[model samples]
Target chain A: EDQVTQSPEALRLQEGESSSLNCSYTVSGLRGLFWYRQDPGKGPEFLFTLYSAGEEKEKERLKATITKKESFLHITAPKPEDSATYLCAVQKNTGFQKLVFGTGTRLLVSP
Target chain B: EAGVVQSPRYKIIEKKQPVAFWCNPISGHNTLYWYRQNLGQGPELLIRYENEEAVDDSQLPKDRFSAERLKGVDSTLKIQPAELGDSAVYLCASSFGRGSYEQYFGPGTRLTVT
Candidate 1:
């Protein structure tokens, strides 16, 4: 069965602290990996999509990278506003919208 | 363009009561999806539609849950006699079938069943 696991279920950091969240997966084949940021009571906001290993994307203070067995969402100099649960999902080439998701990592940045 | 839209941001009800949620995807998006998210968990796909057709519903609980996407645009999800375990956020998302890897999400409907 396809599976996704994220480490550091919860992380607390002071403002300006940098950290990285990990998402490891085991699937039959890799098509794409997605990253999202979800605030409390709101749906997830799209962050990054990594199609293959060694690929990276950035937005503001967040950087996402993907590899064969895992993906990482790295936050640089994060602020309190950057705090939220980060989600990772994997979609295969089977031509379906089904995405296997990891539980997610809750991040809290305090000033 | 407007993003995905969902109605009833929050709903609180007792067990064995019927509840419904609505969604409107971005114009021109051919794919629509419904997901269930528990607190602290990632959203899980409950159903998916491809131009008014339900392409995936393997995870949906057919015993009490049903969904429809009329005209391939707006959609609705219904739960009959909702159970306490049904308390979760219902999220609606849409993506262009033109191979767009990104899916836009709406503010979810948070359901609390007592």
Candidate 2:
């Protein structure tokens, strides 16, 4: 069965602190791995899409790196505004567009 | 352009009652999706539509849940005889076309069953 697991269910970081969230996935055939940031009462916002192992993408203070079995979202000098639930999802290579998602990691960057 | 739109940001209903949620995807998007998100969990796909046809609905509980996307521009999801476990946020998303990697989402409708 295809599954996605996100670790560190909740994290509290002080402003300017750096940390990483983990997403481990098991799929029949890896097609794409995606990261999203969701604020309270809002739908998730797209962050990055890594299609292959050893691929990495960055935006401002956020960087995402992927491996064969997992992905890491690294936050560098995160600010309070960066606080939100980070979601991880994976798409299989079976020609279906449905995404299997993890429970997500709740991040709180305190000022 | 405008992002996906959904109506009735929040709703409270009693069990066994019928309720419906609506969604308007981004203009020109041919693929639309509906997902249910529980507290502390990520959104789960309930159905996927390609134009006016439903291509994936295996996860939807057909016994009580039904969805429709006529004209392929907007969609509606209805639940008959709601149950307590049905309380969750219903999110709608759309992509430019099939196989598109990026999807834009709406604010979602939060349903609370009492």
Candidate 2's residue-wise lDDT over B4-113, tens digit each?
Answer: 99988999999999999999999999999999999999999999999999999999999999999999999999999899999999999999978797888899999999
Q: State the displacement of the C-alpha of residue A58, model 2, in Å, after optimal TM-score superposition.
A: 0.5
How many steric overlaps are in each model, in order?
Answer: 0, 0
Off by over 4 Å in 1: none
- Report the C-alpha lDDT of model 1 over A1-111, residue by residue, as the tens digit: 889999899999999999999999988887789999988878899999899889999999999998899999999999999989999999887757488889999999999
**Which is the leading candidate under lDDT?**
2
Candidate 2 residue lDDT tens string, A3-109? 99999999999999999999999998998999999999999999999999999999999999999999999999999999999999999989565899999999999
lDDT of 2: 0.96
| Best candidate (score: TM-score) | 2
TM-scores computed on chain B for all candidates:
0.97, 0.99
For every prediction, compared with the true complex, DockQ reads: 0.87, 0.89
Task: Tell me how many residue pairs clash in candidate 2.
Answer: 0
Task: Name the lDDT value of residue B53 in candidate 1.
Answer: 91
True contacts kept of 2: 0.84
